[model samples]
Target: MTSLYDADGQALACTVIQAGPCVVTQLRTEEKDGYKAVQLAYGEKKEKNTTKPMLGHFKAAGTTPKRKVVEFKYFAREFELGKTLTIGDVFAEGDFVDVVGKVKGRGFQGVVKRHGFGGVGGQTHGQHNRARHPGSIGACSFPSRVFKGLRMAGRMGGNRVTIQNLRVLKIIPEQNLLVISGSVPGAKESFVIIEK
Candidate 1:
């Protein structure tokens, strides 16, 4: 994330994202696939790590193996198989888009860290051990079992999150980078899908 000066000469915080240098690998037609969508593939992979079946799929598209393949449904422009798309082709400065990606994964966590929960007990009067612990789950006999959907200490993070309406701050076509307003989910090097 960085800050850039806008036309008003005021500093605007932004995050530069590598939007794409995606390739069209497959096309979905209403008559054949019952849906209209374009399948775009990105990120290169070694031939040794890819399966034989996938090798054939990429061969048919006249491209090498790619790691991430996503289907997008839009008709802004006609896409051709084996065609490469850059940030400039699909987006321009001032365009608003939605970014979808997986959030960073944290191993099993307790309620205080996972759910923004306050500590169960105070630090004084021998309450030191109980501060970080989750309090009693529920009643003793009324339900017998803990009700579902109860927020408690459990696995957390590593969920798919979507940030909507982020305005495009700038576009650097030479390097195929997009600068957008605000932060996005996921760890560094994680893949994300941008939608208009």
Candidate 2:
């Protein structure tokens, strides 16, 4: 969960992602659903997470019950209803994977912490007020324009991110665990996708 190791075994920092033995709840085809994809369901929560429409979705698939449905675009294979997917089939140990998840939200923050700006050069330079301020909105008299897409501080994190090509270390099929070599986003037990 913290570091990565190559095949020869050297430590590197990366993220770990645990894929699933997801259930094939829905199958989409180009002719019918206008796309080729498979809808997979993972995790099982209490009835609160299962709505009436979702209950019908599970019932139609004949699955034992689950939350968290995600669709994959592996258009080559055809998945039928109620088919159970396993980690061993989709990925193996030593395979490279991409981990996608929403990062933790760090509410509102200032420019110093958010954007990595070096504040105010030095305290003795009579620059106390500009210290953490974004500084310089526009030109004085030239074009006189504040360009868009500037780096300023506001809300941070809680966004979807995809970390690519993380090597898989251990695949424990018995415990349904994946000891990937590196760090994954979100806290422990947070849902994430591991894709090839």
Please give each candidate's TM-score.
Answer: 0.94, 0.87
Where does model 1 exceed 4 Å of error?
A: none
Cα lDDT tens digits, model 1, 49-158, are: 99999999999999999999999996667899999999899999999999999999898999889888887867887775788777988858888888898888888889
- The C-alpha local distance difference test score for the whole of candidate 1 amounts to 0.90
Q: Write the per-residue lDDT of candidate 2 for residues 108-163, one digit (tens) a residue.
A: 98888999987656667666667777776666677777567777889999999988
Residue 89, model 2: lDDT of 65
Q: Give the TM-score of candidate 1.
A: 0.94
Question: Model 1 clash pairs?
Answer: none
lDDT of 2 at 190: 83
lDDT against the true structure, each candidate: 0.90, 0.78
